[model samples]
Target: MYKVRMRFSKKDFMIFISHLDLARVMERALRRADVPLCFTQGFNPHPKISFATALALGVSSDGEYVDIEIEEKIDLNILKEKINKELPEGIHIIQCQYIDVKSKPLMAVIEYSTYIVRCVLADDVNEDKLNALIKDFMKNKEIIIHKIVKKKNKTREKEINIRPFIRNLELLNKEDCNCIFKMTLATGSKGNLKPEVLIEQLKDRMKISILLDSIRVHRLGLYSIKDERLIEPLEIGR
Candidate 1:
C-alpha cells in the first residue's frame, strides 16, 4: 500500500512560485521530512508524487492538492506531524488520508471551484454595485474572451461563448469601499475556466480599470460531479 494524498494552500505572498517549482520544493521538503516514500524503480529514481492540478502562477488557492506514494502503509497522523515540522510557511497539509478505492484523486475529482477577486475601486464599490454588475454579466448569452490555452502558443479566435462554460456564479461584498469580487470559477480536468479571463472581460464590459492595485484571488473549494451531482474531495459520501 503506497498511495497517499494531501491538500494545502498557497497564500497571497507566496503565489509567485510556479507549479513546477512548487513541485520541486515539495520533493525536497519530503526528503528533509524523512518519510519512507516509495520511488519509481528506474535508472533515475524519483519520488512518486503527482499533483492533481496546478494553480497558475501569481494566483492563490484554498483547495490545492497533491498525491504521493509511500513505501508502506504508516500512521497518517504521525506522517503528518513529521511532514508539518519540515514544511515551510503557507504550505500546511490540512489533511492526510488513505486512498479510498471508491473515490477519485484530487486532479480527476475536481470539477469546479470558487474564487474571490479583489480590486481597487475608482468610485465607491458597494454590494449593490457588485451584485448589479455580475448580474448583468450573467445575462449575456455569449461572453467572448481571449482564451490563453497552451503555454507555447495562444489561440486567437473570436466566436467562442462563455455562458455554458460557467456554472454556479455570484458576487460578494461592497462594505469595505474597495472593490471585492467573490465569483465561483468553473474548474476540473474536463473543461476549466479561470477567474482572471472573466475578470478581464468584466473590466472591459464595465469599463473599470485595475491600476497598480493588486487583485487578491482566493479559491475556496473544489467539487467533483458524479451521477449529475457534486461531491466534496475530503468528504465521505453519504
Candidate 2:
C-alpha cells in the first residue's frame, strides 16, 4: 500500500459545507476519478481516507490537507488532474505527494493556525478607537473568559485565560471604514482558541459597537510547533 497526501483549498460557497460533507464529497470524487483507493476490512468497508483538520463551519481556508491510502502507486500529476476534474467548484487540489505512513498524523502535530479577519465597522466607529482598544488588549498579561465544561452528568462554567493561547495579533489594513487584522492562535488538541471569542472580548472591553454578523474570517494556514518554531505540516516528513 502507498500513502498520498493532498493539499486543498476551500473557498467561495464551499465554506458553508461541514467537515463531514466535505469528506463525502471527496470520496465520491475519488471514486469517479477511478483512483485506486484502499478500503478498511470489515462487513461494511470504507475508504481509508482522512483529513488533517476539520475547518469550522462558515470559515474559509486556503490550506487544508487529506491523507489517503491506495493499493497501487500512480503518477501524482495525473491523479491530481483527474480528481480536479471531478471535484465541484470552490474546492480545488493544490498539491499532492507520497508520504511516510509511519510519521505522526497531521492532526496530532498541528499546534497553531493563522487567520485573516475583516471587521465591518458600525457607521459611528472610527479607526483610532479600534487601535486604542487593540493596544489596551495587548497590555494585559491575561484575559479571562468563562467556558462551559461538562463533568459527569452536570455542566458548569469555568474561567479560562486566553492570553497564553494568542501568539500574535496585528492590524493589517483600514479601508472604507473596515478594519482588517491578522492573528495567530493556538490550535489542535493541546489548546484551541477561536477568533470569535477574541473579538467578543474586545468589543466588551472597549465598549465599541461592531457589525458582528458581517465579520469575515479566513484561515491562512496551520502549523506545527517545534522548539519555539512554527513548521508547516508538509515539512514534517521531509
Candidate 3:
C-alpha cells in the first residue's frame, strides 16, 4: 500500500459541508475519478481516507489535510489533477505527496492553525478601545471559560483555561464598523481550542457586544511544530 498526504481548500458554499459529509463527498469523487483506493477490512468496508481535523461548521479553510492509503504508487501530480477534476466547486486539492506509511498521523502532529476573522464592532466600540482591551486580555495568566463536553451519552459543562492554547491575537484592519483580526491557536489531539471559544471569551470577559451576524472565520493555514519551528503539513516527510 502507498500512503499519500494531500492539502486541500474548502470555501464558498462548501464551508457549510459538515466533516462527515465532506468525507463522503471525497470518497465518492475518488471513486468517480477511478483512483485505486484501499479499503478497510471488515464486514462494512470503506475507503481508507482520514482527515487531519474537522473544521467547524460555517468555517472555511484553505489548508486542510487528509491521508489516503492506496493500492499502488501513483504520480503525485497526476493524482492531484485527477482528484481536482472530480471535486466540486469550492473544493480543490492544493498539494500532494507520498509519505512513509509509518509516519505519525496528521491528527497527531498538527498542532496549530492561523485564522483570519472578520466581524462588525458594536456601535459604541472603536479600534483603539478594542485594541486596548485585547492588550489587557493577553496579560492574564489564565483565561477561563466553560466548555461543554459529552461523555457516556451525558453532556455537561467544564471549566478550562484556554489562555495557553491562544498563541497570538491582534487586530489587523478596521474600516468603519467592520473589523478584521488574526489569531493562531492550538489544535489537534494535545489541546483543541476553536476560534469561536476565543471570540466568546473576548465578548464575555471584555464586556463588549459584537454583531453576531457579521462574524466570519476563515482558516489561513495549519502547521505542525518541528525543531522548535512551525512548518506546513506537507513538509513532514522531508
Candidate 4:
C-alpha cells in the first residue's frame, strides 16, 4: 500500500465544518479529481483516508494534515493540482508527498500545537492589570480547572491541572484595545488543551470582563517533541 500525506489549511467558512463532514468532502473531492484511492474489501467499501486531529469547530488552522492510502503512487504535483481544482473554497492543499506506511501516524506523534489569540478589550480595560495577571498565571505551579467527565453514562466533575500542558504563553502584541497572545500547549494523545479553555481560565482568574465572542483564535502549527525540542510533524522521521 502507498501512503500519501497532505498538508492543508482550513479557513473562512470551512472552519465551521465538522470533522466528519470534512472527511466526506475530501473523499468526494478525490473521487471527482480521479485520484487512485484504495478501498477496503467489504460489502460497502470506503476510501482509506485519515486526519491527524479533529480541529475544533469555529477555529481556523494553517497546519492541518490528512493521510490517504492509494492503490498506486502518483506524482505529487499532479495530484495536488487535480485535488485543488476539485476542493471547495477555504480548503486548500498546501503540500503533498509520499511517505512510508510504516512511519508513525501524525496523531500519534503530535506533542504540541501553537496558536495566536487576539482579544478585543473594552475601552475601560487596563493593560497593566492584564499583563500582571498573565505573569501571575504563568508563575503558578498548578492551575486547576474542573472538567466534566462522563463515565458509565454518568457525568462527574474532575479537577485537572492544565498548567503542565501549557509549554509557552506570552503577550505578543497589544495596541489600543486589541491584545494578541502566542501560546503553545500540549496536544494529541498525551494531553490536549484548547486555546479557548486557556483564555476562559485567564479571564476568570484575572476577573476580566471580556466576552467570549471577542476572542479570536488561529492555530499556527503543530509539533512533535524530539530530544526535548519541538519539531514539525513532517520532520519527525527525516
Candidate 5:
C-alpha cells in the first residue's frame, strides 16, 4: 500500500461537524472520487484513513491533516484535484504528498498546535491591563484548571496544572473591546490542552465577562519535532 498525507482546512459551517461525521463525509467523498482506498481486512472493513487531531466542536482550523493508504500509488496532483472536486464547501484540500509507509501516524507524532483566538472583551477591560494580566499569568509556575474525564464510565472533574502544557500565549491585538491572541499548546498522545480552557482561565483572572459564543478559535497548524525543529505533518517522516 502507498501512504499519502493530505492537508485540508475546516472552516465556516464545517467547523461545527463532529469528528465522526467528518470521517463519514471524507469516506463518501473518496468513494465518489473513485480513489483506490485501502481497507482493513475484516468482516467489517473500513477506510484506511487517520486524522492528525480532532478539532473541537465549533472550532475552525486552517491546517488539518489526514493520512490515507491507497491500494496503489497515484499522482499527488491528480489525487488532490479529485478529492477537492468531491468535497463540500467550507472543506478544501490544501496540499498532498506521499510519505513512508512505516512513518508514525499523524495522531502519534503531533506535539503542538498553534491557535489564533479572537474574542470581544468587556468595554471596561483596558488593553494595558490585559497585557499585564497575561504577563502575570505566564509568570505563575502553575495555572490549574479542572478537567472532566470519564473513568470506568464515571465522569469526574480533575484539577490539572496546565502551565507546563502551555508553550506560549500572547495578546496579539486589541481594539475597541475586540482582542486576539496567539497560543501554542501541547497536543498529542503525551498531553493535550484546549484553547478554550486557557481562555476561560484568562476570563476569570481578568475579571471580565466574555460571551461564550463570541470566542472563536482557529488552529493555525499542527507540528512535530524533526531534527530539533518544528515541521508540518507532511514533513514529519522526511
Candidate 6:
C-alpha cells in the first residue's frame, strides 16, 4: 500500500460545482486514469480519497488539494500524465507523488489558506485612505462583529470575535476599479473565517463599497499546527 499526495486546481466552470460533486467527478477521473487506488473492504468499496477544505460555493481556485491512497507503487510521472489526460478541462493535476503520510490527515494538517478575492467598488474607491484603515484594523487585539450561526438553512444571531481566525489581509493589485485582496484563512480547532463575513465587516465598519462580479479563493497551501505555531503540512514527510 502507498500514500500519495496529489495537488490540483479547481477553475473554469468547475468552480461553480459543489465540493461533493467535485469529489465524485475526481473519483471517476482517477478510475479512468487507471490509478491503483486502495479501497476499504466493505459491502461497497470506494476509493480512499480526502479533500482538505471544501471550497465554498461559487469560488474558483488554482491551488486546491486532495489526497488519495493507492494499492501499488506507480511512477509519479506516469500517474500525473494519465490523470491529466483524463481530467476535465476545469480540473488539472498539478502535482502527484508518493509520500510517507500514512497517519497524517490532510484536513487536520491545514492551518492557514490564502485566497484572492476579486471585487469592484461602487465609487472612485479612495483606496489610499482606505488601505490605511485596514492596516490599523489588523493590528488591534480585539475586533468584534455579529455573525450568523448556521444550524441548517437558518442562521442564528451571534457575535464573533474575528481576532482568532484572521491572520492578515492585503490588497495585492487593482485595475479599472477592480481590487484583488489576498487573505489568510484560519484552520483547525480555531475554526475558520468565511470571506463573506469579512466583507460584511469591511462594508459595515470600513465603509468600502465592494460589489462582487466574482470572488475567487484559492487554498494556496496547507500548514500543520504545533503549540499555537504554524508549520508547513509537507514537513510531515518529504
Clashes of each: 1, 0, 0, 0, 0, 0
Task: Quantify all predictions' global Cα lDDT against the true fold.
Answer: 0.72, 0.87, 0.90, 0.88, 0.89, 0.76
Residue lDDT tens for model 6, 208-229: 7776445455556556667866
* Span of ten consecutive residues with least summed lDDT in model 2: 121-130
Q: Write candidate 1's Cα lDDT for 51-143 as tens digits.
A: 766787787777777778787788888888778787777777777767753455567767777777877766565567677777887888888
Write the number of the candidate with greater lDDT, choosing between 4 and 5: 5
TM-score of each: 0.84, 0.92, 0.92, 0.93, 0.93, 0.88
Query: Which is the winner by TM-score between candidate 2 and candidate 5?
Result: 5
Residue 83: error of model 6 in Å? 0.9
Which runs in model 1 stand beyond 4 Å of their true positions? Answer: 101-105, 148-158, 207-213, 227-229, 236-238
How much is the lDDT of residue 51 in candidate 3?
Answer: 91
Give residue 197's lDDT in candidate 3 (0 to 100).
78
The total of clashing pairs for model 5 equals 0
**Candidate 6 segments exceeding 4 Å error:** 150-156, 212-219, 225-232
Clashing residue pairs for model 6: none
> Model 2: per-residue lDDT, tens digit, 33-151?
99999999989999999887788999998888888889999999999999999999999998898888776778888899999988876765566767777888878898999999999
Over 3-98, each residue of candidate 3 has an lDDT whose tens digit, in order, gives 899999999999999999999999988999899999999899988898988999899999999999999889989999999999999999999989
Candidate 5 global lDDT: 0.89
Give candidate 2 regions above 4 Å deviation: 123-129
Worst 10 residues of 1 by lDDT: 229-238
Candidate 3 off by > 4 Å: 124-126, 150-156
Q: Evaluate model 6: give its lDDT.
A: 0.76
Q: In candidate 4, what are the lDDT values of residues 1-238, reduced to their tens digit? A: 8888888999999999999999999999999999889998889998888888788999898988888889888889999999999999999999887878888888898889999998876654666777787899899899999999999999999999999999998888878788898999999999999998998988888776656788888988888887899987766543
Scored against the true structure, residue 51 in model 5 reaches a CA lDDT of 92
